[model samples]
Structure formats: C-alpha cells, structure tokens
Target: MKIRCRSAVFAAMMLLLVLAPGVSRAGYDYVDISNPFLRKIPIAVPQFKSFSGTPEEMKRARSSSQLLAETLAFTGYFKILDPASFLFDPQKDGIVAPRINFKNWTTVGAELLITGGLVQTAGLVEMELRLYDTFKEKLLLGKRYKGALADQRRIIRRFCSEVIYKLTGHRGIFGSKIAFVSTTSGNKEIYTCDFDGYRPHKFTNNRSINLTPMWSSDGKWIAYTSYAKGNPDLYIKNVREKRGTVVARKGINISPCWVPGRFELSATLSFTGDQEIYLLTGRGKIIKKLTNNRGIDVSASWSPDGKKMAFVSKRSGTPQIYIKDIVTGRVRRLTYEGKHNTQPNWSPKGDRIAYTAIADGEINIRVIGVDGNGLIQLTEGQGDNESPSWSPDGSLIVFSTNREGPSRLYVMTSYGTDQRRLLEMPGEQSEPNWSPNIEGP
Candidate 1:
C-alpha cells in the first residue's frame, strides 16, 4: 500500500512550539509512516546521570543507559549519535526541562535527544526517562519507573516502548521474544530468546526432533510438533510452568497454528490418509475438519480477524499458497509466479502475507498482498531463506538463512532493509516464531 507524504514546510514549523503535555510534535506524518522506504530519525543519547554515592551503583546506572540506547538503535528507526562528538554534556546541561540547551543539541545535528537519571534508594532503584525534540524544544514524553536493581532491562524496554508510541502512535516490540528450532545441542530442540537475541532458554529437551514452534496469542503456551514418543505428534508446552502434553491424535500430526484470540488452534493431521487442516481445542479435542483436498495441505496461518486462513497445498501441480474462507468454505490460489511457494505467514495488520518462494535456484523470502497483487521479493543472491514470521506489530520479519555458512536466524524490516544476523550458535537454526509483547519479565 502507498501513503501520501505531508507538507515539509508545515512539519518544520510545528517543531518551534512547546507541545502540550502527553501530546507529541515529533514531525512524524502517520500517512507515510507505514512506508518502509523513508529515512530514519537521528537521535542522540548521552550517558545517564547517576545520583548515587557508591562506585558500584554508578557503574550499574551507566550500563542501564547503554542498554536502552542499544535497544532503540536495533529497531532500525533511529541512528544513535556518538557521545565522543557531543557538543553538550548531559551532566552539566541538565537532564530535563528548561535546563536543557536545545541549541547545543541542534548544533550537533541531532533531531531528537533522550535524557534520563538513575538513583538508588534503600535497596531498590528508581529511574526517570524523557524524550525531547531538539528543533522545537519540546518534551515528547516523560515517565518514571521503579523496581529492583536486577530489573533494569525490563524498565528500560518499557520506557523505550513509550517513546515509540509517542512518535508513531504504536507500541514498540522491544519486550517481545522469538522461538525457533535449534540444533545447538546436537539435536533439534525448541528454544527461545529475547527479541535482541540474548539469554536463550531451551523449551524442549526430549532429545528428538522438534519443528514448527508456534506461540499462543496470550504468550502463555507454545505448540509444536515433536517426535519424543517415536511418532510425529503435536504437543503444547506451558511457557511459564515448563510442562508439556501431547495432543494425542491418530497420524502425522504437525503444523499447529493458534487462533488469534481464543484457546483453540488449527493444525494438519493425516488420520484420513491425506494431510488436511483440522480445528482443535487447546486440550486436543477435534472441533472440525477445515480442508479435504486430495493433495497435501499444511502450514495454516490465520488472518488477524480469525475469519480466513492461508495455507500451503499441492492441489495444483506443485506446492503453493492458498487462501480459504472459513464461513463459506471457499478456496482460491494465492501464489502463481513461483513453482514452489510455501510457509505463508499473514501479517498482523492483515495487509500482506509473507512466504518462501523458489526463484533462480534459491529459496528467497517474498511478500504478496491479500488480493494476490503487489508481489515483492525480499531475499536473493545467497543460500536458502525460509519460514518467514512477522513481529507482533507487523514492522519486522524474522527468518532463518544458510547464506552465512551454517543455518542461523536473521531479522529485517518489512520492506527487506536492515537485514542482519540475529544470533550466533553452534549448529543450524530454523523456523523462527516471534512472540507477542510479553507484559512482564
């Protein structure tokens, strides 16, 4: 979809006045904000002020600020300015309000500035963060967070989410997590880590092959296909409690996809001699059969509203993406350009669907509109890239690629920019699933 740009002259003038409380004049035009081809904002983040007396407390404060700056830069929305060339010292120029020297920031070519202070009280820590628009000299947002000393990462992520909300009217996905199948332990197991690829935790250790991990909408459970009992069966793992249960089906149980807002799921089962989609509850009771095609049907992804679904099927000559209407039992082909198109993941915004396409002898990532128009290729000129999954906000995509030798995970913007390696592990990794925004640590 295309969006019109606003007048540049008017946007420049809006930066000169003091914006109202809780209102932002950050010069972001929502009409064109969805366009991924725009330039990123330039932001400056100086060291946070420490109000503690001990050296250990001061060191913790500095590290906390650096973590926040790294998180913002990883979003691909802001270019962090180096502190060595800063014209003004945050300690001397002040951290908030009238004490800030807006001219000093503007002289350094920074459009936005972030300032904060950290202090230790008793056994806990308190932090205050603020975002400022340098040209207009306006405070875009201000908030305070209090928690234990070990909760600094969570606190900073919450504040960064607020800054994104003020600028783009949408919450950021910094606090989210990603789940994928990893062979780091010499076997394929389900593992999860933070969105920035830190602190990886193993979810399944059955010593057998596990594939296709899918998170529930509420972020409480993960459903995947495992071979723990010597059969290809579906199992759901409680994320918090670290417990697992088998779905207990007849044959070839795989590709489980949870409905948007309920405890039900749609998965592929081969009990009837052919792979087909079936709706089931969280506890493993079958609700109804979704597809009865003669060819193989698998990998079902639901739309945002839960009324429609996209899946891979071989009803035609080769495997391709197909869309099905739940209400009327109507099916239509959704991909035609490529001979092999699979792993279709509907975006959270319900505008586009991302999948894997085989072109020029390589598996590349591609996206197509809901109506099967505006097809765009995202990855090319390297090894295979497959299993595309969208972030909660539909602004980013995470997939696995073998372009760098061993298969490893990667993340990029929706428009295929800022593509970078996500994590470094020993063995091959694939089938990444981005989780929803988790509420707490």
Candidate 2:
C-alpha cells in the first residue's frame, strides 16, 4: 500500500538544541506513580511577550500563551496559576533569562514558571519558550520554534510536549489526535480533533452514517464503518490524504479492531447470517475466523500482547464480555454481573479492560482485571455513559455522556476521578478513539 502524506496549513521549524542551565531534581515519574495518589504540580504560565509591533501579533501572543497553559493543565499533573494574582505582569516584564524575576513568581506560590516571546515577521511566527524552576532559580528547558502565524497552537503544543518530557521521562500526548463520530452536519460522519478538542475538522464527507472510528496501530489510517453504499461496509481511510477504500464483503462489516503492532484487524461480519468476528489484513483480505458461535458476536478488542481478545457476545442469551485466547481458541466469560455489558477496551498497559455495563437501569463505565478479579465501576449517576476508550498510555479513558444535555465527550483518569467534559459542540458526539502519540518534527 502506498502511503499518502497529509500536509497541514503551516510548516514547523523546530530547533534541535534545548538549553537547561542548572541542576534540577529528578521529576515525578508518572509510570511509577499510581493514579489515585498522584498530586498535581503547581506551575505558573504568563502571557507571552509580543515583539512584532502589531495589534494582531499581540492578540496572537496572548492566545498562544493561554493555549499553552490549558494544554499543561489538561495533563492532570499541573495546577495553573491564575494570571490575576501574579505579582509581575508578564506582558510588561521582559521574557529573556537575564530579566526574569524568580522571586516574584516564587512569592506567588509558583514552583515552576514558563515564559516565552512571540514575534511575527512577514507571514511566519517565531516563538522562544523557556521553562523555569523557581525554587532553584534556574532554567530547566528552552526551545525555539518557527511556523506560520496560524499554526500557533501546534507550535505551543510542541513546546508543551518538550516540557512534559523534561519533567516526566515520557513525552506528553499533546501531538496525539482523537477520532470520533459526530452528527453535527445532520448526518453521522467521522471527525477528528486535537488532544484538547481543538482544530476539529471532518474526516469523511460522505453525507452518510458512519460509526466506530478506530485508528490503526501506527496512527496512519482510520478504519470506520460507513453506510454510504446502502450497507454497512468497513472502510480504511488515510487520515492525511482524506480518501477511503471500502472493504467489500457480502454482509455487514462493523466494529473493526486492529491487532497490536500488526497490519491486520479483527471485525464483526454478518456474511454467515449471524454476526461473527474474523481476522483480516489491512487490505481486508480474510485471514481466519476467530469466533464460530451461533449467537451475535461483535466489538473485538485486542490485548496488548496479541495473545487474547475481549469482545461482546450473546451466546449466553444476553450481551456480555468474553475473552478468547487466539492460540487455544478457549473462550472465558468475563462479565456476569451486568445484564447487558459490551464495548470492552483492553488497556494498553495490559492490566485491565474497560467497558460499559447496564446496572440499576443506567448505562455506566466499568473496569475489570485481566484475570477476572477486582471489578470496579467508574461512573454511577452521570447519564448514559457508553463507548469507553482508553488512552494510548492507559492513564485516562475518554467516553461519551448525555448527562448535561446532548451527548458530549468526557475524559477521566483510569481510576475514575476528575471526570470532565472534553468538548462542547452543537451535535452529539460518540465513540471517541484516541490515537497514539504522533511524533512531530
């Protein structure tokens, strides 16, 4: 298969060298930190300085600064300092290292600070960002980024990823994207947005019903089910190229799940009169059938090691989650508490599987251990919560809820704390799939 290159509106020029001036303590390792006991870091982010001598430059600088602050706060690790309480005005203060007042920030209860300067020249914008450890009074990380004036969000997110990497050993998911199904345009279509729900744009304009947007293991392609040709057919679309190829089959092709670290996928097909799961290549060539049950079987989620799969089956006369071993073909029932349980998402860390279960006449999110022990319920009284998808790092889960009004996407930690809505849009959003962190240049 030929890979298609997707071009953005702006080009990024990232500097290779990063300057860290003084000795800094080893930051918190999130991999070792448990979700329930982790504490948020206190940090301050002031408005970026403007040097372009134009009103538009000043406005852009302020927006970029706020964007950076929000991105950092969204990580669930940082407590952003309010700008109204700052002792020194970031707009009036100098942004260079020599002119920074560490005491001013430290007195305001900021353990860390981020300051940057933005300048727009011709059609391009140049940004210089520096992260500071106020207690130590030393520069922790600094970078120079250049891009189009319209691409300020991307530039800021790039720097934020660097800051996360310097503080935590792993890079942040700032560059990762979310694929979802939305009904904003009077029809169900696949749409995508940034990790923070910005830059939302439609991926498929087929003007037909689309469902279950799943990203490939490599994040290059998105597989979804579309009813454009009168039947539910599976389609693989190159996200950058904005084109799709249908996986032609006899019957319904729905609920496609990619095998970890491979070019093949497992999906539910109704070619044999009843829905069953089958394994296929990236090009939709049938490799083998995984489920041979007479009842309806769908929604396949691959384990991290590719040794097992968790899926929804009705073989017991009710929808429930079941795990199947790929080699031995041994099927084990995982959920017996909920009357209707479905949409099992295997965690990327290989510890737990998150799914949606109906209990007390409401649909809620639940998680169970891989060994069928330690079952925990995440959501209780919010609304009808369904379609729980785990983040690439397995630290957070993004699901949809209709509690407030229309259905909107929400993100919560893996332990079911900090439940916050992700985006507020016009249409109903569902089936959120987080992409793997795509490395930026």
Candidate 3:
C-alpha cells in the first residue's frame, strides 16, 4: 500500500511538471525564463534631439522623449539605456552626419535602436520618429506628425505605441494613472496621479491610515479603506467629487476589490467576529456570503468572469491563498509551496493571481495559476511588495515596494521585467489600483 501511494504521488508530480513548467521550481523569481522560446529581445533607447522649437516646446519634447522611453521600457523585452549612460548624442541628419554607424551601436550591446527628433514647422511643432534594427542596419519605423506645442503628450504617446508595435507586436500603456494609498505624511491618505508621477491628487483628507484601494470600472471613482471613524471603514470617493460615501459597515472592513463583469464589489468584512469574504452589490448590500466560518478568510479577488474568487485565510495555520466558486461555494487551496501568503489580486484576463508570500516574515509578491499551479515569485529581496494590481490589458502590474527605502509605487510586467519607480509623492503610498483605459477629461 505504501509503495502504491508513493507511486501515485510521483506520477502526479510528473504530470504537473509537464503541465506547468515553472511550478515547483527550486528558486522563486519575478520571471521563469527557463523555457526560452525566442522570447522578446531587448532594445536600447536614447533621448531624442530637439531644435528650432520654443523653449517650452523644447522642454515638452524632452519630457515626451522620457515618457516614450518609459513606455517602451514597460514592455518587459527592452533593456532600456539611461540617457545619461549614452556617450553619443542623439542628433538628426545634417546635424550628426545623418549616417548612423551600426557597428558603433551594436558594439554598445544594443540589439535594436530608436532615434527621433522634434523641429519647429510654422506655428506648430513637428515630431519625427525612427526605429532601427542595429543588426540589419535598416530603419524599422519612420513617421512624422504636426501638432500644437502643448499637444506633445498625446503625440508622443502615439509615437510610443508605434515603438511598442515595432518591438513587442502590441501597444503600450504609457498614459495611465494608478490610484493608491500613502503614509509618508504621518498618516495614510488616498491619492491618484499619473502613471509617471506627474500630476498627483489627494482624495482623503482625514489623518488616518487607508488600504485596499480599488478602482471603479469607469476609472473615475476610488474605493478604499479608512480609519477616520475608528476601525477600518470602506469608503468610495470620486476622483473629481465634493463628497464620498461609506460603502460598507465599520469595524474590520478590509480589502474591498472591484468585481469584474459587474458594478459590484467583493470584500472581506469581519463584523461576525471572524473575517470572511462577502460579495456586495453595487449599492452596498450583501448579495451573498462567499465563505463560511472556521478561518480568517480575507483578500477576496474576483476573476474576470466574476464567477470565482481568490483569497487568503488562516485555515492552513499561517496564510495561504484559496479559490472558491461563487455559485456552489466549492473551495480549493491555491498555494502549497509557500508557507505564508496573502492578498490575491486576480488577473484582468483571469489567468492567475498575484499575491504576497512571506519568506521568513519578509513579504514579496508572487504569481500562480488559478488551480494552485505555476507558483512564480515576482520580487527578490524586498522591504515589502504587498498588493499588486494588474492593468486593464493584463500587460502591466503596479505594486508597492519598500526595497529602496520608503514605500513607493513600482510598475512591472506580468512576466516581471523592467521594474521602475513610478511615484515619489510627499507621503508613503501603497495598495495600487490600476484602472481601465478610460478617456481622460
């Protein structure tokens, strides 16, 4: 009997190995780059040159160049170069001989290169962009646009989308903003700003800590946690509004997340003495209880279909993420390799859940499949990267990292690449909520 049991276990392990390449791997890292199938290659980006434009127009070009570099870098395949690291200046034809030496560029470890410049034409400014294949010594993309000096942001963003297509076969999300919480001001407050930390707006004025901020389907309203009235309370505020409404009851109203496919919310409320995940209607009424008692069930994340939920609980002693069906109340454990796990945020397409797994009490976010497979850790050696929110397109994830000092915003791909600091506001911020791509006001 014992031999048969061991044989069955070995067979199961072999089957899992064949099904999930990264699951049960020895080491945990942001990406499982073991099964390399000609994954996207890296590229080098240099700042674009600007000439014959207004002082303000020149500044806009420079800023647009930075944003464009950032957008390509976010795609996870580009090994972006720092503009300061470039020994060669970015100049156009007649300015730097117009002939780029491919050998010089390829020697610098650049597989692909991008070049562009902005010039003043009439009362408007003209932006010209060119992407090159250093190996082929040919231009991959070339385009020019004419727009007002102040339209630099949109024009450059269009140019960036072209860059991403030239490399990753897709467009990039560069003009998006993430709403989250910050505690650097001695207390946590709700804030929403640009993806690159340009224009920040404070949402909550109370001197209390906030957590679990979730963006509305429309990307305008922000639902979050506040202790303003004592005990954790769930409050929803419009990004542009004169007031906010209490969505849930007081006392342990933790981790409210937006429910996909509908205007409802799924949250963990502990009013019954122990935490349990609940599905609340859009109007703040309890539609159903998703979990029973016996454990501290929290951190409920809804799949894109809103049919299933992923959450963490103390049912396994420490904490482990669990998935449950909203219809039949059937439950399943989603993590076994990690001893400590929490905060499971479902992917936009519902393929995986990104959660925090504590290694010796230090927390780092990791990703896993919906059926407790493909456990891939996304951060290595960190202060904390607790809550991870996926972009509407499932291409990017914005989370908080304390590795580099105070907790600030960081954005990376679903496969984890090109990690970059996203915000440096006046206060500590975390629990990022990446909204859907809604048209700006």
Q: What is the C-alpha RMSD of each candidate to the true structure, in Å?
A: 8.3, 4.1, 14.1
lDDT of 3 by residue, 274-371 (tens): 77788777556788788886878888888888888888888879888888887877988888876888888888768889987788777888999887
In terms of TM-score, the best-performing candidate is: 1
Candidate 2 — worst ten consecutive residues by lDDT sum?
1-10
Q: In model 3, which residue pairs have backbone atoms overlapping below 3 Å?
A: 182-428, 182-429, 183-428, 184-428
lDDT, candidates in the order shown:
0.84, 0.84, 0.69
Q: Over the stretch 137-247, how does candidate 2's per-residue lDDT look in tens digits?
A: 777788877666656777888888878777765676776788998999999999998777887888888898999999987898899999999899999887788675788
**lDDT tens readout by residue for model 1, 308-395:** 9999999898999999999989999999997999999999999899999987789999999999999999898868999999998888
Q: TM-scores of all models?
A: 0.92, 0.90, 0.78
Ranking by lDDT: 1, 2, 3
- How far is 296's C-alpha from truth in model 1 (Å)? 1.0
**Model 3 misplacement above 4 A:** 1-63, 81-111, 121-124, 134-143, 146-148, 242-244, 248-250, 272-274
Clashes of 2: 0
Predicted structure 2: lDDT: 0.84
In model 2, pairs of residues that clash are none
TM-score of 2: 0.90
| Cα displacement (Å) at residue 221, model 1 | 1.5
